[model samples]
Target: MKRIPMEIKVLIAIFLAGVISVLWYVYDTKAKRRAEAAAPTPISQPIDP
Candidate 1:
């Protein structure tokens, strides 16, 4: 059996990092939307000085 090269390993790591970041962004966006839906509505009022 032959050993793998360090450059290949580095490339694999970078690819994995990119995939992870994209997944995280998607998950965070969904969570934010859900939170906004669940949040209470603000009362309507006129501002006075």
Candidate 2:
């Protein structure tokens, strides 16, 4: 079997990292949006004791 070139291996590693980063961004954004949506709004507090 022939050994792979170092340059090509480095390129492939960089590409995979980019894909993983994009996927994570999407996942985190969705999670944050959902959490914000499900959270309750704060009510105004009375000043009088």
How close to the true structure is residue 10 of candidate 2, measured as C-alpha lDDT? 100
Expressed as tens digits, the lDDT of each residue in 1-49 for candidate 2 is 9999999999999999999999999999888778767867422334467
For each of the candidates, give the backbone clash count: 0, 0
For model 2, where is the 10-residue window of minimal lDDT? Answer: 39-48
Q: Which candidate is the best by TM-score?
A: 2
Per-residue CA lDDT of model 1 for 1-49, tens digit only, reads: 8998999999999999999999999999888778767867522344469
Query: What TM-score would you give candidate 2 relative to the actual structure?
Result: 0.78
Please give each candidate's TM-score: 0.76, 0.78
Positional deviation of 39 in candidate 1, in angstroms? Answer: 0.7
The true-versus-predicted C-alpha distance at residue 11 of model 2, in Å, is 0.4
